[model samples]
Target: MKTGLREKLKWLRKPDSTPATADNTRATEPDRPGWFIPQKAESLLATPLRRQLMKIIWQRTSVSAALFAELYQTPVARFAVLAQQLPASEYHHHAYPGGLLDHTLEVMAFAAKLRQRHLLPAGAAPEDQAREAEAWTAGILYAALLHDAGKLAIDMEVTTGENQLWYPWQGAPAGPYRLKYRKGREYALHPVAGCLLATRILPDSALNWLAQYPELMASFLYCISGQYERAGVPGEVVQEADRASVAQYMGASAGSVLDNPQPSLAKQILTALRELMHTRYRLNNPQSGSDGWLTADALWLVSKATADNVRAWLLQQGVTSVPDSNIRLFDEMQSLGLIIPTTEGKAIWTCDIQATGGWSPGRPLTLLRVSPERIWPDADGRPPVFDGRVSPLSSVPEQPQACGDAPAMSPVDPGTGTGGDLLSELTLSLFSGTDDHTAPQASMTPPSGSEEKHIAGDGLLTVVPAETESQPPPVTEVNPPVPASITPPVAACSGQNFTDWLREGLLTRKILINDRLARVHMVEGMLFLVSPEIFKLYVQSTTGSTGDEWMLAQKAFQKLGLHHRGVNNINIHTCQIRGPRRNSRVKGYLLTSPEQIFGESIPEDNPYLSVLEEGSGTAT
Candidate 1:
């Protein structure tokens, strides 16, 4: 099958007439009409790197150039015309001229590689798989190519000749165009917008062919629409491939890109919170407008106030990526395990505060519950625990899930014995999205085998729910303060030191394991460290260095020969996260010897995580 395509396309292979150089020169030449030299799509894509990428893409198809051209090249050309010199992001990945095109092409190539490993129509018979293989491949390619095409529509204001407004839906510009990123643009809006512009980039023939396969078409649509959670395997393949491309450009690897860490954002947030708590925030005050109340078990911060202040603080500190919306900020905090969740797995809690001084809020206040230890790792630094009780009000009424079109299974609230409802109708009117806000929460019921368990070994906290109502629930430390004695006093940062620090942190409960936001996971009787993240955390903690320095630590760790390299000598390994609803993948480095970190007492393998065999077709 491959030979036939190669033979037919042999004549198409030819040397480039002009020497290849970076196309970014054209992007920055001039925004003026006189200097804006419009070029043909084919000519624009004639650069050596783009030509080579196209060749790789065609090779992955294993089809004749004529057939592949009609299927892929045509659409790519159309995309080039529209994307000409546009960047992928303002200040992030591929933020150069023609970066968007390069990133898209790279993603397509990477997706092609990943597609070979999966037999599409998932559980279909071999005959069916063979029959639908090409369609599935095309679907994956189309999904990857058009993944970020919506950026043209939503992120930028485009003007053609004579300052004429240009819309992507109106087709490629016939004359010179000027483009500028929109200020205060929603970072996530482009994904959905991409769906609308798909028809403009993709030919009807290709779309019709893709539409023939219902399952593939659905996934393709979902992916382009940015509903990855619903897109199934196809979405995952596109996401991973996209990550690989981004990682390559960002000077990281696929493994680290698997779960791209916001290197300084998390640290910045924590720092801001610490500063706010220390200076501006009024805690445990009986006054009605006090910033928060710190009880024995949890620190309850007023939701809106804290989010607003944190965002303002970060913005003032020159962190522009902080979410403008309070809901998104809350979600970010919860995802980072900075806040303790309610029984319904939500970040914001509706509680009534009754202070010992006979001062009480007349109405229920929306608050974020944070574990005390996360704020004050040293017990001596904490303020005296509050003497009053903070009881949750009755469960709020469930609202429609705004994030998705359909309603998912509502998790029952442990406090009310019913599904927790929408925050909008209650105090969180501004927050309108799915109620699945995950964070750490102490369960009232006994732990189930299926539930995530925290074991105290190597400094991990073994949190046992308090037996009495009077006693406070023990909090598990997420980011504990590193101790001086744990280090060997080498003073130099090295791989051994990183590992030693990790081991000591786990043992001392300075670093959390098996938590929602944890970077380390026990899988297949070995330790899986989420790359770049764990390394970034170590770098940030030890040297307080940022930006690409973690790569040094990663290289140092690789030299120790502690990690098992995967196919193509990939340092990152894939782990399947088996959840109650669906299964997902996590990429990291698996330790060659778990004993090196844990010694004789190895913790139980994370029940939710199972390492996937490299290049394996199956999840297990």
Candidate 2:
């Protein structure tokens, strides 16, 4: 083994270990952070050994449930049972004496918290707020308990002497070196292997169903396999639990597992996720003052896709059986609109199932072979047709017989869309006082087998009509920048936004997006959009002079943020006038529009743009 890994292993087994009892608190117990799910402490205590540990712990001192879970998992009985069967010392990490028991506790805690925050459900007292916590607790606990169950075949070692070599079994031999087990064989491959073992441990009824249905197992595997990744929620919980347990067993800090159990980690993850949610909110109704309907929709799609793909892959890989009740986790994400189908041409589906092999926590994966689908524009945008579709993409539909061929279509209520385009009217109703003129927005049609979907267009629904020449005599113009009267508020941007409008503008205008590049571009766009509100606020809050490259960026974002608070800040302007100190190597540009700038980019120009350059070399 490498010296670093060896040192790490040695560190994990250090002495001065704290007893695994719930009552003993770590002296450094601040607010235990990092995705904590509140579990039923009383319930956990009912499990035989855990129950005993709990009694032992409280007898000494009271501790938070989180702390109790951390300490309770330190007992030897849990992982030791599984480890006894594994002969290869190398696989020990997977079933290392107490690892499984420890991870299971942590996962349960985290899952419980998730359910509460997301309202995952707890039965009768339901609202969205209550449901998520239930789902999280159930899904995560199951995965945690069985995660490392397959590590029984691994070996263990306790070496001594200068040259560490020899075997534990009699025929295993002995030397000047006193080795407990052979080298080069460890718990490195336990997660994938454990998944296979899970099938056997589960009742045959459960096992047989999943065996026939790969998707069921895939969901479990996705959660377990991703335990090593740094960013995701599931992996973070598992890794932290594993670390906390090890830290108690050995006297050393198992920082690599959970690292610092700081509140900052929780805040950071929440902050990033919130930003993502905010950006989605603004994009859905740039000019519509709607709630986070669009953002909610997008998130739902992501969750669904993840769940579906995981289910599909697991079944394909032959991990078919799982608890029936637990199957609802996959279903809920779909119903809540957490996962979405791939946009047409957005991604290519690869037939290669081996791509996900050798899976581990924190490992990066490329979900190839996913079919792409085009983004559809909302009703308020363009294209009059909203109901059942029957036409080809390139062809425009004829006017509806009911509405007739009137170019002056009725104005839609400004902002009433919800998560599924549910409540757009409340936000965008301009003429509420006079109900007769307002027209209702059309509803979306379900997908038919073979429609050619299109990319969601930039939020420009239509060009406003110029005031007719024959209207009443013009009123005197106000010299001051502020408008004399505020127009009624329209459905416009909401939620704190972070999109980098400059990057998005560049990409959308300059890049020729095919299927493959679109999704990648969108993900990049999402990241940029959820980054910071500094850009939009900067532009709407100021004007030129100090304006230069940075100012132009700020100005562009004001539009993307959809600054429709009132009539005074109706539009956004962006221009690269001049930097105070200019270098020819760095050129600049500006943009101005009616909506807030959600995101932007400055990618290298394409060959087509290169051909449009005015000068051959210098300014000849």
Candidate 3:
């Protein structure tokens, strides 16, 4: 190991010298100025819920778990001290007091449970599994436990009793620490923070054991660094556990994993809506309320407008598991408190709104009415109501045809039914990113951590509920840039995202690029990506997005005028297929440059493919 890694290993072992019990370590606790999690690390872990988590951890990795205690359980205790009292998220499941501890225990237990089914270091011989199982299990548990630790300091502000600022990377807070989610903290990379945090909590001995398994250690690091795609089975285990935990907590599943393939569908609906509200839709606008309108008494939003926007946004962000129906979308929103129940307890309402200025005639529209205070700001200007008396146009639907569980295209409300069932899941503005205090605004550049799958189990409050992931907490400043250089921005939908995606995919093994005559290749240090398939992928990612549809993306790449043509001026190439039956030609393009997208070495050329470049006849 290099000197720097050696120094880091030495530092990770530093906590082991102290007693694992908080009481024993209390006197020696570093005198720092931030509020601690408000409970001793040992005590918190000793709780019934956490004890059960330890039980699972022990069963999964008894040898390593024993070592955990032998090391004074000091590192584990340090994490608990920093994580106590803080909620895993501002809202959604487990967003209340002590949510972090609950969530941590849940994820650890879930990861262990999921691990029981996998033969990890997958494809390894049975003997190798027996030898490495405990170590692998321990690494996963540790990874799951610390996956979101970055949220501690990177996403939120931890303040001292005297209100002094404290960062978790500096080490565990000295005493009871208060958490204030930083405003506009959407840009911080909590996963990167988790990697930094692991330095403080992972003991050197544990590191040594884990590092011995190169594949296991690499996956472990990939997971901690927020690149789940590379983490493989271990990452999948963590993800599955996260999803299951979120489903269990948010009442999506009553602990029945087998109930639905999409156990977290309800959570997904809410999350999609939340993301739309955060980055795309406008609420409480005065002149033009394209998405919704909020007034002092209530928040009135166009039903289809909100639904379409939420669905489109979620799709663009790569959440493909969302339900396809607007009715289903409304049902989940109504179930999750994104919309209030009607007098008869349905999600949709029909009413006529006349312009307050009397410049326009009365118009009928389907709308979702919610509590005004839920999204309105007391300090800012309010929306003006229409002049006409807003009355329910019709009675609620009676499970008719045409729309599935949705009211007919028109509105209907029967005064007969009572307020049926109020939503149990009321999301505070935590996951949505902005509340009333932040006025509706236009789109800004995507945040720095766009590549990361947010999932806040609660994404912008949109994506996964079973994961109970929270949005990255607010950051006080721009985080130091990563050592890896980012690809410069290119024209939207110009196959630019595909290039970057392919590069990362190659590095992370998300895309297959090393096989013979692979669909994608690097030649002359430039990309030679397959046609149509690459275009299809880009299309799928931006399902509901406008402007950059499939054909448009293909055209955009063509317009870039970077793809190569052969000496015969052929952009498409035909290669001989060495088969008994026949030969074929596959169409692809040679993108301009590799350094343009990856900004790093390709590491190695694919030994199987011929290198192709523009204005060159060489096939080597």
Candidate 3 lDDT by residue in tens digits, 1-620: 32332343344443444333343224333355333445577667765445545655565554454454743255667788777667776534455556676677667766766677688778899978977777788778888878888888676777766667877665555555667666557644886678887767776667776888899999999999888878988887776566545544543432232111222444455555444444445543333334555554676667655555555544433344444455666676665566786777777776655445443223555678866544432324234543333455665543212233432221111111212121111111111222111111111112234221121111121222232222222212111111112211233355565555556555433344533324565545557666545554444433332222544566556655566555655554422222346533334566656666556545355443455333453454
Off by over 4 Å in 2: 1-80, 83-100, 114-136, 155-182, 186-188, 199-217, 224-620
lDDT of 1 at 279: 52
Which prediction has the highest TM-score against the true structure? 3
Tell me, what's the RMSD of every candidate?
21.3, 28.4, 15.6
- Model 3 sits at a Cα RMSD from the real structure of 15.6
lDDT of 2 by residue, 272-377 (tens): 2232222222222222111212221221112222232333222211122211111243222222232232343212111111112321212112221111111222
Q: What is the lDDT of residue 526 in candidate 3?
A: 52
Number of backbone clashes in candidate 3: 27
Greater TM-score among 2 and 3 belongs to: 3
Against the reference, the lDDT scores of all candidates come to: 0.64, 0.27, 0.54
Question: In model 1, what is the error at residue 457, expressed in angstroms?
Answer: 5.6
* Segments in model 1 whose C-alpha atoms lie over 4 Å from true places: 1-35, 254-620
lDDT of 1 by residue, 135-181 (tens): 89999999998999999989988887677888877666656776666
Candidate 3: lDDT of 307?
Answer: 59
Show the lowest summed lDDT stretch of 10 residues, model 1. 435-444
Q: How does candidate 3 score on lDDT?
A: 0.54
